[model samples]
Structures are given as structure tokens and as C-alpha cells.
Target: MIILYHPRATRPRSRRLPLAVLALAAALEGKEQYEIVDGNLEDDPTARILELIARHKIELLGVSAMPGPQMVAAMETSREIRRLHPHVPICWGGYFPSIYPDAALNARYVDFVVRGQGEDTLLELLDALRGNRSLDSVKGLSYKDMFGLRHDNGERPMKGPDEFPWSPFHRLPVEKYLGPSFFGKRTAVHHASIGCPFNCSFCGVHAAYGNKEKMESPERTVAILTHLVECYGADSVQFYDMNFFLREDHARELCDRMAHLNLRWWCEARVDIMSRYSDETFAAIKRAGCAMIFFGAESGSDWVLEEMQKGITTQQTLEIARRTRQFGIIPEFSFVIGNPNDPDRDTRETLRFIRKIKRINPDSEIIIQHYTPTPQPHDAGGEMYGKIEVPFPDSPAGWAAKEWMNFTLRIDTNAPWLKRRTKKLIDNFEIVVGSRWPTVQDIRAPRWSRIFLQVLSAWRYALHFYNFPFELHLANQFISLRKPKRESL
Candidate 1:
């Protein structure tokens, strides 16, 4: 049995941990030999997949889809597999499918979809398939019958984080999949837990994992870290948790354990959580080789923050940024633009907030992203649900394609404006700094090339500041923009 993990794009690095976790579980169960075939790792995996299916007489294929363009690719892959190997069972599992099982099951090509945590459920399904047993008894699965009727087994209780196997990083081509930025260094990605306690309107956290946050036991987290550093020789570990600091003591214990090992790591945490952590805890995290932290400061406007249910004020965000910088941890912040309720004034305010953050930490990086209305299960009850236009398709794969295309087109259309505004804003900042610092030309680009220079500078900054490959794709769209030519149908 082969488990093919299809990435959302041509780059397979970001989804490494998820794929590793799934593969590791399959290996541990001793059910069947599992291998990860990343679609994005090489040229399209279509031909290779056909070869593998025929050579191995593969019986089961699993595709992971996130909410965007990748889902479309997954759908296309499933359809292709069904066409070539009708006897094989193809499954879809990931953030989008887990939240919207109906949308996934409704797709003609998808035989099954798994919601929430998939490790145990997936293993069970694979075992049943090997024995040719009925799938109705499988927990945490949604499947369709020959009559085209969908049957949902309903979600099982959330799995404890400790129950999950350590990621099977060793199974993948580690060096080949590492991001360009970390090419020279050995990096491992892991998650300390699943779910978020907050109920952000535009976020799918609560929908994917219930409102309750789960923390991996300190021992389990330490064991993974130990394996990465001692076994894999990982120099840096990145935590992909929704909120790394939700359980303060758990975070502190993890930090304390990490401090015993010489490993550099990074994690995402909420501004409010950072502000509330004791000085000793912050010190412990820094001592634990935490080189950087990314905060989801979605907006600088209190109104926008409230609208998003971010549960953090603008002042709180600023304070956290200052304090984080004081602790000598790289404070990477992100903000959302084109907010649904944002007028011209609100947009300007967000840009001004970026300037403020730069002033506070001259070396800090601010990632500016356009707001996207992603629908969640709970979105139906949100105030913005009906008002905000979500462009996602009904099927997981279709939605993925729409998201990728939308993001591509949006960046292409907004490139000139982004370039112009970024230059204007930077020049204005230089003027403010020039009053106090005589060597301020060092801060500003020449007026003639400021726009292009700013665009380049923003791209360079975004490589490390944002999800590199995703931003690279968005940048490519901006660089490729040309007036469209009319075509006849």
C-alpha cells in the first residue's frame, strides 16, 4: 500500500511535518509499507504516479489538500487515479476537507474524506481495505456508497497530541525539501499541539479542531526535540502550532526542556499571550534557543481587531512587539490589508502602523498581506460571513485552484499600487528619520529607482518574513503582469 502526500504547490517543504506524521503512523502500525510521493517535490507526479500504481499494484492513495489552489490539484489527481485505477480507493484529508466533509465527499472522484486528526482513522481504514472489510465502522471518516449516497461516520474525540508519532522526517528527502533560505542549515519542522483557543472569525482553527486547544505533553515534545537534534542533527526546529503559548506552563516546561539541549527554534504565538507571560518565562524561552517568534498582529486598528475577534488591542500588540524585541528574540509581525470594512483611512493607518513597528525595532520585518475571507464551519453565524465575499469553490480541489488563481490575479493587479505605496511610505519614513539621523540616505533608495528598489526590497524581506514559496509565487504574478488581450470563445 502506498500513501501519496500531494502538496498544494510545486514546493513540498511547508507541509513536511503533516506528511511525516501521517507516514510515521502508518509505519508504526506495521500494516503496510508507506512511502511519501510529493507532487510538488519534482516535476508533476502524474507520470510517476501512473508508473508507481502499475508497478506496485497500489490499492490505496491519499491526497492532502489545504483550503486553496492545492485542493484543486488534489481533486484532479484523485480523478486521474480513478480513471486509470478504478479499483483503488482514493481519499482526501487536510484542513479544508476536515472542516467541510460534505464538500469533499460530494466530489465525484473522492472515495473518502477524513475529518480532524487522521492518523488513527487512516490506519484503521487502510487495515480494513487490506482485509476488504466494510468502511462504515471506520471512525472519523466520510465516504460514499455505490448509490452515490454520502455517509458521515461523524468526528471522533480529539486525539491527544502525545498519541501522535514523531514526524517521519527521515523518510523524506530532507535536504532536497528544505527551503532555499535554510539550505545551508539543517532544519526540522514540528508542531507542539493542535487547535487554538481563540475564535477568530476569518480563521478556520475552531472549525478544524474544536475551540479547545490541546498541548503535547512536555515529555513528548522533549523526546521529539531530542530526536531531531541527537538523531537527525537538526540545527533549527520550527513549530507549526496555531498558538504556541496557549498553555503557559506547558510552554515554559517545553522551553526548560529545550534549554537543556542546544537547539535553535522558532514558533508562532499570540501577542496577548506574550504580554501576559512572566519575565522568567520569556527569559526561559530565549534561553531555550528560540531565535525568533512570529506574532499574528492581524491589524493595528482596534476596530479591525475587534471585528476579527482577535481579542488583542493595538496597544497590546505594540507593547508585545517592544517587549519581544527587548528579550532579543527576532520579532516578526504580520498585518492584513484590504480588510472588508477598511476604507482608505484604515489602509493608511495599517501602513502607518508598519512604520511605527520599524521605528521600534529597526531590524524587525513586517509582512503585509491582503485580507482573504476564508469560510469556516462557524462562519455561517459570523457577522462578516454574509457580508464578506468568499471566492472559494464548493469542492476542496476546486477551492484550492480558485484560491491560487485569486491570489495570483490579486497580486498582479495590485503590483503597481503596492510598489508605489511602498516607495512613498519608505520615503516618508526616511524624511522623518532624516530630522534626527544625518546618515538617513542609508535608509532611503535613490528617488529614480525607489519604486523598483522597494519592490525588490519587499521581496527580499518577504522571503524570510513570509511563507517563502507562497510569497515567491505571489511575487511572480506581480512581475508577470501585462495588460490582458481579448480572446474569442
Candidate 2:
């Protein structure tokens, strides 16, 4: 028996489908006896995993992990499993291991790190364990040999979604994952594409899946979503595609079919690419229930954009803001503050630009993140890699440390280049803007509290005084405003 574990990454209310583990399970379907145990649903995931191992003759334990809180939970659970069941092999796959394979392998509990895409790699690894193939033959694998020497078996070429079997939704408690969101009452999530074509410096998509993206056919995509709608009563969907909008024809065709499903959806797209989309396509998208588009408007300065190797220009971001408003779809602009060269100027310019965006489109949502560097090839991250002063931790335990956890979440990154004053300014501004325009995604905040926050923060916003919004901060303690970046799974 094989066990696939999805460590708790978000709150139960914020949990979506564990697509990563589901993808791995899809490969093992019919051929292997396996079960998926989601940590989000369990109060004591480690005990549950140990119970399963004790009950069944488990061959391997596969874990899907991400950065931040998930890594911490995964480490603790894996450590306990190793101590209790010394014979059971533990393997980790996902962004955490893909980005830092060596660090993942550094943990004595983790016997293997399936880097990059894991569907094929995992199956091969299982075969090797059964003596059907040599361990060295498994591409996209990092593992310690019998002599305790680590070896990386290089990268595997990414495959189209069509190449793999559909996710075994029947194996999951589908209703538990269907939750309320800004889109609809019962919202579902789907990843219709594999990887992203663009190679943004700050993003880990390129490192995980390379710059090549293969999308499922619109027919197959619509079919799967139709199943979710008809069988599971999913009224809305949010595509987890790294880059959802690629080709105009693909968008138009997908939208054409999606119009019949009646799903109010949200997705991430490139500002430059969407800028070139036709007005007819935009109308089709809106008609098909495209409520919001999350664009990576990383910085306001053109030089910073070039430095990050972001192909979109500041002008394109502004133009898209205007265009998205015309279509009545909200454009959620996310900015990465604190550039390596000059953080203060970057923060100031980006804040000013965010204000401009709000002025142009009152419904536009702004998400602010500190610039935290990830492990990437120098060329992929541009010259910014050389500018980072702090070295990344060499082990999973070190990464699970409090400061590094904050760094992973990009919440309170104490990077060498960032000043405390600058971080304070960003926080104060975030509070003011978030209060001034309470997020529509926030279903938890009471209507009265939203009105109260807006009324309280109006003067500060109008006066352009973002410093020390103590009242708003204090109000938030009671309101507990939901940040979509953190809440949205």
C-alpha cells in the first residue's frame, strides 16, 4: 500500500482541492493500492498517518508540501513518521522540494525529493523501489543512494494535461472542498494548464515546470468542469493556472463553452498579453462570467520591471486597468515592493502607482508583497540574484524557523536591503487602502464593520497620510479583515 499525504497548508475554511496530491494519485490509479490523507481535515495528521501505516503494509509515503506553515507541519509529521516507522520511505514533492531539493533531502526523514513535475517521476520512483527499474533512471528525482550520497537525476520534460489521467475526484471528499467565495456560493478550483510560458524572476514556476506550458484542450477542460457542476453542484470555479490566459483563440473558445456552465470565475493572467486581447474576446469573457483577473503588476518603475525580467510595461498595466474596467471585470493588481537596487524608491513609486490604479478603476484590488528572493538560476532571476545578501537555509528545519517562515510568506521579510521604516510605511499604507476599499472577497467581515472601516479610513486615504493608522490597525483586531492573498487557496 502507498499513502499520499497533503499537509495542512491553509485554514479549513480556506482549503481548496489538493490538486498536487490528486495529480500524483491519478498516476497510481488502478495499478497501485493507494490512499490520500489530507492533513487539513485531520486534527492529528501525524497520528492518522501512523495509524494507516500500522494498519496497512505501506510501501511508500508521498507528501505534497509548499512553503510557509505547510513546510513546518510537513517537517513535524515526517519526523514523527520516520521515528515510528523506520522501514517506511518518505518522499516529498511540490514547490518546497522542487525549489530546494538539497534542503529537502537534508532532512533525514525525507528519503527522496521529486523535483519539478512528479506524475511521471513518482511512478518511476515507485518502480525503482520495486526493483523494476534502476533508481538512477528516474528523471526529475533527487535521492540519497545506499551509501548515503545524494544524486540528482536531472529534469523531466513537462507534459500536457491531456497526457495524464483526470484527477480522481471520486477518491476525495469533493463536497468538503466546495466552499463559498466572491465568485459563488459553492466555488471549486481547477488547474487546466501545466506550467507557465513566462519566466518571471521572482516566481518559482520556471524553476518547477520550466518555461514551457502545455494546456489541456478546451473540450477536455469544459468536460471536467461540467462534471464538477452537474455531479458536485459547483456553481463557480477559480483556475489555479500560473498563466491562465494564453492564446486569444483558446480564450475565446473556452469562454464560448464556459458561457453555458454559468460559473462566475477568477484567474491569473499577464497584463501585456491581456492588453493585446480583442474587445470581442473581453466581452465574451465577461459574458462567460469572468469576474476578476489577477495580473502581476510587479512594479511601477519601468527599470524595475526590466530588472525583474517582467515583459509587461507600466503603461501596459495602466492600459489593462482601463480595459478591464470597461469590461466590468475587476483587475486585481499585485505589486512586489522593495526592489534589490533601491527599495525606498520602488516602494514609493509603486504606492503612488497603486493610488493611480485605484483612481482609474475604483474596483481594482491591490495586493502588496515584500521582495523575497527564491532559489533560482542567476539568469532566470536576472541580476537580482547577485544583489541578495542573505543566504538561504541549507535544511528544511532551518527553513521552518520563524524568521524564514515569515520570509517564505513574504509577510515580514527582514531582507538585508529592506529598512524597518520602509516596511512600516508599506504596512501603514496597506491598512489604509484595505480599509478604504474593503475587499469584496471578504465574506467574514460584517457589513457594518466594512462601512465602519471605510468611514474611519476615508480621511487618511483622502489626505494621503498612510503613516501610523493606529485606529485602522486596532479596528482590524476586532474586524479580522481577510486578506485575499493569504485566504484565497
Candidate 3:
């Protein structure tokens, strides 16, 4: 049996999550051989997919999608696969499908839609498929019957973080998968835990993992790290956890173990937690070979922070950034460009904040992201606006095919003013980079090659910036611009 996982679009280098690891775990459960064919990595033409299907006798195709264009790519790929090999069952799973299972299930190309925490559910579905049993018994799956779409009630609870399978780095061509920074150096990723405790409305973590926090035991986490270093010769291991250091004790213990291993690594942590950690603990973390840390410093405006329920004040975020630098650990701070309540004043304040931080800590790197609003199951006024709906087909096969294409556009037609202002803000903020940072010198290269690389990088950053505020603005406009005769939601 074969399980193919599609990563996001192939563009200017984006990191591929450990989908191979999850697919391996599911394959192990059913005692099936699996290979992760990244569509983005190798352009999958009709002939290529057909050749693989015939060679491996593939029984299942599982496609995963991130937001925006990737969703469309996934859907299109599923449709193509179905056209070539209709017998092979296709399953759609990921953020987009999970959020809009009903719409996804109704699509023409998807055979099954797995919502939320897919590891266990995927295994279960595969088992049933192997047995030639009815898919209705599969929990967390949406299928279509002769009548219409059939969604199984309730999602399977996510497995404990410890239960997650170890990285399948051994199976993948690690050298090919390595980032530019990993050319001669080894790189690996570890997930210390699953889910975040915070309920930031703009975040998808809460929607995907719920409000509960689940962490792997310190010993198990240490063992994983040890394996990565000893077996894989990992020079640097990136912690892929949404919030790696949520528990201070866990962070300290992991740091202690890491210190003994004497390996370089990086992790993401909340600013509030970092602020409360004792200097000794941070020192230990640095000793443990933590060379860098990324913080979600969403905004400089306190009001925006408060509105997002981020639980950290701008002052607290600044202090944490400062302290991390003081400890000699590289700090990469991320900021959101647009907020729901953002105005000209707020945008200027955020830019000023970015400038201040750059002045205070010359070593720190700032990553600015644009906001997009994804449709949640229960969003404010969502019900009145006819609940943000994706056009999912009723059949499992069709739903799987369309799963990736169903995303809310960045600008809703309903709010022209918001959309116009957002474009202006993005244009204005381009000035911030110029005013605050030294101009980047153009490197001499082949004319065609340099233009291609620059354009690619520009598009990559443009797509990465899409988040809630932008999506909401788009959705609102879409609703408002609809013909008056058309009913809402």
C-alpha cells in the first residue's frame, strides 16, 4: 500500500512539516509500506502519478493542505489523480478540510474527509478500507451515501503527545530535504508537545488542537532528541511545537538534558513564560545549546494585544526580547502587519515599535506577517452571515478532491474600504523596511536568474503574510457585494 502526502506549494523555499513521520506511523499501524511523495518537491504530472500508482499499486492517496493557494493545489491534484486512477481511494486531511468537512465531503474527487487529529483516525480508516468494511463506522470521517453527505458525529480526541511516532528522518532523503543552512550540517525537528493553552482568536492552533495542552514526558522528549543527535548526526534540531516552553519545568528538564548532549537547537516560546523564567533557567537553556528562539510578538499596540487575548503586554514582550539577546541566544521576533482594529495610527505605532526594537537589539531579526481571517465553525456574526461555508460536494471522493480549494479569499468583496486600506497599509509598511534598515545591495548575477529569484521571494513572502484580519475583511466584502436577491449563509 502507498500513502502519498502533498506538502504546500513549491515556491521559494518553505519548510515541509513532518508529514512523512505521521504517514509512517499510520502505515505501521496497518503493516503497510508507505512512501511520502511530496508533489511540491517533485512536480507530479499525470504520467508520474500514474506510473507510481501502477508500480506501488497504491491503494490510498492522502493530501494535506495549508491555507490559500495550497488548498487549491491539493484539490486540483486530487481531481487529476481521480481521473487517472479512480479505483485508488483519496483522503483529504488538514486545516482546510478539518474546518469545512461538510463542504469538503460533498466534493467530487475526495473519497473520505478526516477532520482534526488525523493520526489515529487515518489508521482506523485505512484498516476499514483494507478489510473492505463500511466507512460509516470510521470515526471522524465524512462520507457520502446514496442519499447525501454523511458526517460521523464528533472528532476522535487527539492522541497524547508522547504517543506520536518518532521522526521518519531515516526513511526520507535527509540530505535532499535539508534547508540551505543545513548544506554540510545536519538538521532535524522535534515536537515536544501538541496544542497550545491560549485562545487567541486569530490563531488556528486553538481551532485545531482545542484549548487543551498536551506534552510529551521529559524523558521521552530527551530520548527523541538523543536519537536525533546520535543516530542522525543532527547538528541542529528545530522544535516544531506551537509552544515549546509552556511548562517551565519541562523546559528546564529538556534544557538540562540538552546541555549534557551538547547539541545546538532552537525552539519557540511565549514571551510571558520567558519573562517569568529565572535567569539561571535561561542560562541553562543557552548552555543546553539553544542558539535561537522565536517569539510571537504579534503587535506593539497594547490594544491589539489585549484584543487578541495574547496574555502578554507589549512591555513584557520587549523585556523578553531584550533578555533573550542578553543571554546570547538569537531572538527572531514575528509581528503581524494588520489587526482587526488597525487604523493609520495603529499601523504607525507598530512600525515605530519595529524600529525601536531594531534600535535596541541590532542582532534580533524581525519577521512581519500579513493577517488573514479563516472561517471558524463559530465566529462572531457568522451565523447571521450564513456561516462561512466552503463548497464541499456530498460524495467522499468529491469532497476530498475539493478540500484544498475551499479557502476564504484574503479580501472579502463586502468591505471595499477595508480591502483598499489594507493594500495601502502593506504598501506604506514597505517604507518601514527602507527607513529602519539599511538598503540591501543588489547582488550581481545572471539578469534572468536574479529577476526570477527576486520575484519568487516577493510572492512567497506575500502569501505567507495572509492571516485573520485580511481573511475577515475579504469575507465581509464578499458577503456585502453579493446580489441583493441572493440569500446570506
Candidate 4:
């Protein structure tokens, strides 16, 4: 039996760890002969799919898709697959199908949708298919019955992140990927932990991984990092965990192990974790090769934080920013504007928060974001669900680079001025960044072209976050980021 997975690629030139594909690959290890195919690594993914179909006698095909435009792309692929090989069953999984199982089933080409964590769900599904048994017993499996009735078997228990065999990264097209990360060294994305401790309503982290985190052992984490370094020539790691510092001891242990490897790394933490760290702990984080840390300071206003149930305050965010900068780590904070409670005022507060962070860090990076609602309203009754000009893109790169990415203006807001400026910047971004979607080549564009793009990005942020003139906001930004107070420790 052969199984195939095509995770929509984010960039034509870059591919990070596709954990869903990897996890499924790990499960299939030694059980069957299977090939893992990446869509992002191809010039024409459909043609590649056709080539694979012609070559392999596949028993099962699993295609992962996210919500928005990616679903369309998956639908197209499924259509093509059904046309070529009518007997092969296609199963769809990931964030899109997890919540909208019934809706996803509307696409006649999709044979099944695997909701939530897929390792166990998929394994059970493959077992059922082999025996040709009724799928009614499979948990987290959603599909339409032969009579066209919808059947959703509900969520399967998630296997711990560490349970998946060190993710057959060997099967991935790693050599084709370069550093599109913080350190700008050959980078690999890894998750030492799964799940988030907090539930910020707008976030889907809770939807993907429940509130309680399931983490790998410190020793396992080190081994994985070492494997990536030795095997993949990766010098940097992006933890990509929802919240890595939830346990200070766990973090410190990982840091000590990381220090010996001398590899630069990045991770996300909550502002509340700042209270858990002393000056020495922060210093240790730096010494351990943690070059960057991100905090989702969701909103700027105290009321907004209360509304989002973010559970962290403006004060905590400020304290963390100060400590991170003082300890010689690059602190990146993200804020959400346009929460239901006072969208205009929320944006203003977010702006203030960003400015305050700049004042604290001066030489760090920060993101001020407008809240983007999912294509389908997550809330049935909330403020008539703010609309967007276009549904989110379906491709992996779309997920990586657009509005939610802190780059383009994809979502519309109540604030008139914010909407206007956002539209302008987004239009300009399309012009400068996309000869077709921007590539790493765009990053290396001529100085004037890069400056022009920044000029556009700068004005958009200024218009939304700082009430001051765009020129003044740009000036303040330059002054704040101009000089490093100390040499890299």
C-alpha cells in the first residue's frame, strides 16, 4: 500500500517542517512502502501529482488542507486525482475540515475529512479501509454515507507530539529549503511542545491543540535539534510552539542543552511568563542561544485584553519587553486590533502598545495586526461577522505572507481611516512584492525597491497604530531602531 500527502506549499523556494505530513509518515514507518510528496517543493504541483499517480499503485491518498483558498486548491487536486484514479480514496485533514466537516464534505471529490489531530484518526482509517469495515467506528473521521448522509464520528484522542517518530524529516525535500528564519542561517522548524495554556478567542491554537500542552522530554528535544543540525545542516531552530516558557524549568533545561550545541533558536512565550523569569534567567536564555522570543500581547487596552480573555495585561507586556531587551534578546510582540469591543479604540490601544514596546526595546521587531476573522464567522451572533474583500488564500504561501502575516491588508475593519490606508498598502504591496507572489528574490531586490516597499509598509502601520502623521511615525521608528545600545552579548 502506498499513501500520498501534498501539503500546499507556502513559498516556491521554501519548505518548512510539514508536521502533519511528517506525523503521518512516521505512523506509516515500516508498516507500508509510502512516499511523501510536498506541493511547495514543486514548480507545478498538479503535474507532479500526475507523475506520482502514474508511477505508484497507491491504496490510500491523504491530502491536508487549511481553510480559505487552500481548500479550493485541494478541491482541484482531488478532482484531478478522482479523474485519473477513480478507485483511490482521498481523505482531507487539517484546520479547515476539523471544524467544518459537513461543509468540507460538500465537495463530492473528497472521500473523507479527518478532523483535529490526525495520527490516530488516520491510522484507524487505514485499518478500516484494509479490512473494508464500516467507518462508523472511527473517531475524528467525517464523511458522507453512500446514501449521501453526513457522518461525523467526532474527535480522536491526540497522540502526544513526542509520540510521532522523530518525524521522518529524511523524507522531506529539505535540501531545497534555505533559511527563511530569524538567524538567516540554514533553519529547521520544530515543535518541542504541543498545545497552548491560554485561550485567546481569536486564536485557533486551542482549536488545533487543546488547552493542556503535551511536551517532549528535554533530552528528546536536544536529540531532535542535534539530528537537524547533523543531518540537515540546520544551524538555527524555530520552536514554533504556541507557548514554550510556560514551565520555567522546562525552558531552562532546554536552554542548557541548546547552549552546548551553540545553535540559535526562536520560540513563542506569553507575557505572564516574564514574571516567572529573574534577570539571571533572562541572561541564561540569551546565553543558551535564544536570539528571539515572541509574545502575543493580543491587545493594547486593558479592557481589550479583558474582552479577549487574553489573561495578560499591558503592564505585563511592558515589563517583559524591558526585560527581553535588557537581557540582549530580540523581543517581538504581536497585537490584535478590531476586537468586537470598540474596534476603533482597540486599534488605538494596540498602536500605543506597539509604540511603548518600541520605546522599551528600541532595536527589536514588533507586529501590530488588525483582527482577521475566519472565512466563516467563528461566532454565530457576534457583530454580524466583519467581512473581508477576499477569503483568505488557499495556498501555503498565502497563509505565510498575507494580512495575518503582518505584511498585507487582507481584512477590513470598522475604522474608516484604517480601512483606507490598509487597502492602499495592500495594493502597493501586491505591486512591489508580487511579480507573482513575492519570493526570497524580493528580499534581495534593489535598494530603492526595498525602500519603496518599506515606505509602503511603514505608512500603513503608522496610519493604523500611531495617530501621528505617517512621516513622524516613520521618523520615530528610524530613531528607535537606529542604534544598538550594547554589542551582542
Leading candidate by lDDT:
2
Error (Å) of candidate 2 at residue 11 is 1.0
Q: 328-359, model 1: which lDDT tens digit per residue?
A: 88766766555555444556677668667767
Expressed as tens digits, the lDDT of each residue in 1-489 for candidate 2 is 999999999888878899999999999999899999998888888888888997999999999989888888999999999998989999999998888887889899999999888999988998999999999999999899878898888789999999999999999889999999888989999999887778677887887877888999999999999999999999999999978989889999999998999999999999999999999999999999999999999999998998888888999999999999999999899988889789899999999999999989999998888887776622322234446546778789999988888888877888778899998998899889999998988876779999999999999999999887889989989898888767642
Ranking by TM-score: 2, 4, 1, 3
lDDT accuracy of residue 275 in candidate 1:
86
* Clash count in backbone of candidate 1: 5
Better of 1 and 4 by lDDT: 4
**Model 4 lDDT tens row, 211-267:** 678888888989988888888788877777788887788878878777888888777
**Of 1 and 3, the candidate ranking higher by lDDT:** 1
Off by over 4 Å in 1: 8-28, 42-44, 127-134, 178-184, 378-386, 389-391, 400-404, 407-489
lDDT of 3 by residue, 404-487 (tens): 223133222222224566656554454233222311211222345434333433432344332233433443243232111111
TM-scores for the candidates: 0.78, 0.97, 0.77, 0.80
Residue 145 lDDT in candidate 2: 84
Residue 49 miss distance in model 3 (angstroms): 3.6
RMSD of each: 7.9, 1.7, 9.1, 6.9
The per-residue C-alpha lDDT of model 3 at residue 117 equals 69
Model 4 — which ten-residue stretch has the worst lDDT? 480-489
